[model samples]
Structures are given as structure tokens and as C-alpha cells.
Target: MPVTSVEKDLNTLSMTIVADFASPLQRLWDAYADPRQISKFWGPVEWPATFVRHDMATGGRSHYYMTGPNGERSDGYWEFTAVNAPHSFEVNDGFANEDGTPNDMMPSMKMKFEFEETANGSRMTNTATFGSVEQLQQLIEMGMEEGTRSAMSQIDAVLEDLATFAAGKGTELQILSDTQVRITRVIRGTAPQVWDAHNEPELMKRWLLGPDGWTMPVCEVAQEPGEQYRQEWENTKTKERFGFEGELLESAAPYRSVTTEKMIGMEGPSTQNELTFTPVDGGTLLTLVITYPDVATRDMVLATGMTDGMETSYLRLENEVLASAE
Candidate 1:
């Protein structure tokens, strides 16, 4: 998680930043390939960005805008010059008008992104070449150095989300049965690592919470069939508590498990959960199926924004547990 360097070369009129991430190279490449993922961290934390249109191929055009804190907005565009998946891509990056047209008044830079696999993880080098020293200095004065650094710092979170939603790991909700719904994700780790994260209470406390400022004060797991488990969390500020207790119905370490779950404070019949972990392309494909009493119960849970909340929690699991697992 160390940023190796951010350097500028006046002679070459280029700016470069090098950073390493504890993620696979494909996940890093995907951050640029998917526009929805790109929008998550494409701008500085203070000035969030929104992508109007994105086409990630050679000669494709990407139009986006970043809104400043004062309601001001800056539009930008990227014309892809070359694309080599999971390796490198080149683009002409510059300012754009509100109508998604290039603005002639501003200077454009030829930007290239290169990804390389390292012993620790993946290394990314971003190089932006200007036409002249003056142009480089102009952009430097415009806060490009600091702004780019701020934006790049958010890539770790994006990578985590990408790993979970990688190819074939559909984020789309799927109805499995009249009383069941399923969602699958590809986490960046082996089967054992994923199993540990689910069974180990200490690890569960790190990512299972729905949102920030929530702490899991009680996480007890009995990893044997017919054993009972309970997890409880509370909002630090409001002291609002929520949790679920369950009995392990079946246990097959690092592969599959089935459990019966009941929310402590919620009014509903206990649900059945089946989790299967399969190894795929050096990662773990986790399939989660939850069966409620009826379709109305399943739809009711979905309407509470549970999908988004669960997705967020899974992303945190990828970042905090899977990515760093040995």
C-alpha cells in the first residue's frame, strides 16, 4: 500500500506516478475497462466525478465531468488511441465542453497506463506526456499533480469492488426459486481464505458490518454442523443494534456450507442459507443462496436496499481479507 513515487520530468515534459496494489493484474486492468467502476474513483475525494458516456476501446470516446464543492464543474474527455487488455492502453486526454465536444482552448496530453505483475502484487505506472514544457507547467500550475494523486489514491477501493464483480461473477440479482435469491462474486483469494473469513469471528468483524461507524461487538461462530452461531453489531453513535443468529446445518470446510438464519429483531420466518466456494482462475467464486419462507418475504428484504448493502459489505471483504490473504 505504499505509493512508490510521483515524478515529473521537465526534459521529457511527462508526469508519472507509480503505485503498488495487493490485487491481481486483471482486477487493476478492469478498473479502467468498466466505466461504472471508473466513476467510483475517477476524481479527487472532494470533487466527485460522473461519467456521461464511456466507450473503452480503440478510438472510443469517454466523456465525464467533475463537480467541485462550490457547484462548479469541469468537463473532460478521453479518446482512446490504443488498447491491450490487462496490460497497457494509450489515450489522448483533455478538457471538453459541456456538450461532450473537445475544447480547443485547453491543451491535451497523451496518457499511457501500464500494468505489471510483481512478487507482492501488481504495479501500475501512469505516464502523461505534454507537447511542451510550457504546457506541462501550465497543467502543474492547475493542480494536476495533487489532483491526480488524490484520484489515484482511491483505486484500492475500486479494485476491491472490481474483483468481486469480475467476469462471470454477476452482480445482477437472480431468482433461484419461489422462496430463494442468489448472488455470486469472485473474490481474490483461495477457497480456504474465503472460508476462514466467514468462520473466524475476528475476520468477520472487519467487513461484515453494513456501513461505517458500526462495530460488531459479538461474533461467535460454531463451525460444526448443528452448532449455533450469533453475530451482533451496534451503531457507535446511536447505539442502535442489529444482528442475526443461526445454526450450522452442514459444514464442508473451504467448499460448501448450509445454515439457518434468523434476525434477532426482525419479524420473519428463519431463512436457509447455502454458501459454496469454488476455485476459479486463482480466485474463489462464492455463490450465496438465501431461501425465505415465501416470495413476499424475499421481495420485502430486497426492497430494504439489502442488495446494495450486501454488495458494499462484500467489497470490504475483498479489500480487507481476500486481497491480503496469503
Candidate 2:
């Protein structure tokens, strides 16, 4: 209903759809920037999406999958080529394999999304350019138009539910698959500040302690890729101590980081952790995606009160570290 027009230009081998929404331009832009909000309506009603990774920056990539009614799944990916923020962005969109690699057998397209503020609300222009006429016709035959319409129709509900994704919601855990889990929390601080808090030893020791009785004794942060980092925490009263060490695999300053983590002194497969910080309406949306060695390891980690402890640490970060900065 929000769609005003859907045009197919055979000469240019492109398809364009323009839709109007009853929300501010920033709100509409944020819907796409935040993975949690975008996943809610990125697929057809029957095929809900789960975005395991979303980095809204140039050269960044997003990985998501849509699940069908009968448990079928279709994976997709987007490589951001240009990101102008709140107005327009361009990406190379394509189908992906189960391992999150591009499916070259399927046609990929150059897609651009433009947003603007209208008198009533906002408008979004989505244009996808195919390599050839045959490719465009192929996607059209694959129910591309119908699927997009269904996806856009569900965005109204997500736009109106503003408070759900706002700040102070605490740490949220989402199981993306048997091996992957995503933890999200809106920290009341800027992305740079939040990133620094995690990277700086002094700042981390001030807030990374889980509970009131715990104290961080050692806080060694990895400054760059291939660098090893270690952190140790102790129960102040009981004198119990434990630690974790990891080598940084990737780093993008205030935006994203990937690392391999293992409990120090333990012998087992390590987990891969991907962290991303995105600026939102309230503050920074900190997302951590952890891939365990297996389902058993995933479930075991969750059963250890990991989420609750994370929430406590995040709260301390807001109150002690960020609040002091303000």
C-alpha cells in the first residue's frame, strides 16, 4: 500500500520501486542501519529474516538469511560500496551460500537506496540494476516484486515500535543458528566512547567487572590484528580468579572488530567473536556475534548466566565510565 510505483526499465536493465512511509527520514534510515530493526521486515511475512552481521559502512558487508514456512532458508548478502548516511547508499546485493559466501551462480545487482523527507512523512527509492535484460527478467520471474512488496508492507509496525529498540533495554541475546549467537545492547554513549571503553585497559577495568563482588585485575587489550589480549577477573571476597585470552583477527576502529576467544588455561576449541558498534537514536547499538565450536558449546555458554553478567557490566559501563565522561 505504501508503494507508489514499481517501474522496470528494460533498456537499462533495472527495476525501481518507490514507497512512502509515515515516519521521519531519520527513522526510516535508522530502520535500515540497525540490523535488529531491518531484519524484522527485510523478508516476506512468511519468510522472516535473521541478520547475523550488519556493518553499515563503506566496504562493510551484511549477511542474512530468510526462513520459509516449511523450514527452507534463502541466504543473501550486501556489500556496501557507498554509504552517505540518512539520504542515500549503494550496495552490491547478491544471493549467498550457507557458509556466507556469494552464490555466483545467481545474478548479483548494483542496488541503491535513497531516502527523503516528504510533507507527511518519508519516501524511499530502491533501484536495482542488473547486468543484463535476461537477469532482470529472471529475478522478476523469481517473485522479486511480490517478495519486496510483502517485505515493505511489514515495516510500518517496526517503525511505530520505537521504544523496543531504544536505549536502556539491557543486553539481548538472539540465537542466529546452532553455532552463532548475537548479543545486542544500546549503550548510552557514543560509538567511539564505547569502543574506547572496551579497548583501553583503564576504562575496561572500571566497568567490565560483571557483578558488585567481582573486580577486574588484569585488562590487556589487543591494539591491532594478530595481537593477543588477555583479561582476568577475581571475586573480591572469595579471591577466585578466572581469565580469557584472544588474538584480534580484525579491527575497524570505532565500528567493528573480530577476535578469537578462549578461556585461559582451558583446552578446547575457541570461539570467534564479531563486535560492531552503530550509532542510533539514543546512543550506540553494540552488537556482539559469537560463533561457538558447536551447539553444545553454545548452549553451555548461555546456561552459565552469561547474559545476566553482561547486562551488569554494561550497566556499570553506562553509570561509571560513560556517565563520568558526561
Candidate 3:
């Protein structure tokens, strides 16, 4: 875990937070630059953030929102003032509506982030300036200090995920055929560990759930060819449940597996999934290819935002499952 310290200056109407992470400066910089990575740690653990739009260049704008445990959402936007890759950036940050319109009633602030290489890892300092002492007090009263500190503490976890995805691995989302889509990621773990994470019910329960407030109530896996597997997840608060069950078409321990998937509530054709795991320098390169019956069906699944869900799930797999293996 990282150490985050916040200092508030009422006279200057400013707050500065400094944190040291046991990760390389470039890794930390990349995490902030990538919107998907930003979503992993931009908020506290309980309230996760989802980035709707991200443009990391000078004069560009970014819009995102944080979703609370009870499904409440808080929207915000950032207008980039300057961007120095792997070093620093400046932004005007403030609250926004669902349509990304700036909220006039909210106080806007200027934020600057600086990253420096340290002996063990990297050091980052964030300085935020408010218009007046009253405005600063208003934000502090809204739990900004505690929220920011809690968010900063998750940087190490995000850094681990970024490192896994950056290890000469490419995330390719391609339409292999009219009815097929392929997604791949080079994960950081041995072949055996990766296999366990996918095949073991206990390990699968940890990171298989896509988002924060969801839990896998039922997870059953039979790791042999012709065996059946099923997984079910529910929103703990809403009690809404959804899942899929499939039978293995091919199974090879620590290497490859193929299955036929029929989604529970989704009406359509079943999908064929093939997973290949290969040993890389320090981990395994896992490639997943899913095939549908027709282009329209594939497009329909894509419209359901499966890519983002899978990406987030894989990130959790790296941070929680693979990191634990080490």
C-alpha cells in the first residue's frame, strides 16, 4: 500500500496531497494517462469510477462518474490545460451533469499533478487550488480529503494491473469473422496459476464479478472435457441475478480450453469460446476468442458493453488473482 498525506492551507485555499508508490514513474504515468486504468483507481474502493470519455492531450476534455454502493452516481469533468507525458499535467476540474454540461452551482478547481522518480519507486504530488477559503471548505466538508486519500491508496493495485497488461502484451479487439470476436491479454502469472484462476471455483469467485457491488453466489466448475460449468452473479443490493452455463468442448490442463456458452436471460444462439494460454517471459499470454452464429448476434452482444466489462474483469484478475500468486 502507498502512503498518502494531505495538507490543507486555508489561507491560500489550496490542498496538496503527496503519495509514494512502489512502482516505476513511467508505470504510474501510464496508469493516469489511460482512461480504463484511471477507472480502476480514480475513486475509493467502495465507490468505483467509470470513465465515459477521455482525451489526454492539451486542451482536451474528460468526463466520468463515480457510482456509489447504492447505485447513486456523481458526475464530473476535467479540462486538460497541459500534458507532459510521464511527468506532469494540469487540469481544471469540476462537477458536471449527466450530459457533461458544467454545473454552475459547484465550485471549480485547478489541479496539477507532478510525478518524480524515487529510489524505490515513484513519488506523486497533487496540488489543488480553490477560488476561496469558503469554496475549499465546502469540498472538504463533502469528504474530498478522505475520498482522495482512499483513492490514492489503490494506486499500487492499479500499477500492478498496468504492468501485467504492459508486459509486451497487446489488447486486441477484432472481428475475426462475421460472427466471431477475439480478445487477448498477456497476463502476469505462471501457466498453472492462470489455469487455477480460471478453473478453480474459489479463485474464480474473487475477480469474476465485473463490478464492485456484485457477488458470485454460485460458482461450479468441472475441469474435464465434456464436463459442465456454471456461474451466477447477483447484485447484492438489488438482488438481480444473471449468469451462464456451459459444457466443456475441449480441456487441456494449464494450456487450452474450449466451451459452449448459453447465456441465461439472453435469447439468441449460443457462443463458442476458446481460450489459449502460453508461457511468456515472466507470465502467461492468454488469448480468448468467442464465436457467435451470425453478425447480428455478435453486434448485439457488442452493444451490451461486454468489452469494457471483460477488460475490467481481467484487470481485477491481475490485481487480485495473479498478484496473490506471487
Residue range 1-326, candidate 1, lDDT tens digits: 33689899988889998989998887777666554567777888888887655555566667788989998999999998887766888999999998679998998899999999999789989999999998898999999978877887898888776445665453455664478676666677877898899998889999988767899999999878989999899999999998999899987676678899999877767998877665545376666778799988888888897767777778889888777775
Per-prediction TM-score, please? 0.52, 0.96, 0.55
Order of models, best lDDT first: 2, 3, 1
lDDT for 83 in candidate 2 is: 87
lDDT of 3: 0.80
- Per-candidate clash tally: 0, 0, 0
Model 3 root mean square deviation, Cα atoms: 15.9
Best by TM-score: 2
- Winner by lDDT: 2
Looking at model 2, residue 143 earns an lDDT score of 95
Off by over 4 Å in 2: none
lDDT of each: 0.80, 0.93, 0.80
Better of 1 and 2 by TM-score: 2
Model 3 CA deviation exceeding 4 Å by range: 172-326
Instruction: Write model 2 residue lDDT over 1-326, tens digit each, in one string.
Output: 68889999999899999999999998999899988899999999999999989999888899999999999999999999998887999999999998778999998899999999999999999999999988898999999999999999999999999888767678999888899999999999998999999899999999998878988889889897999999999998899999999999999988899999999999999999999998777788899999999999999999998989899999999988899999
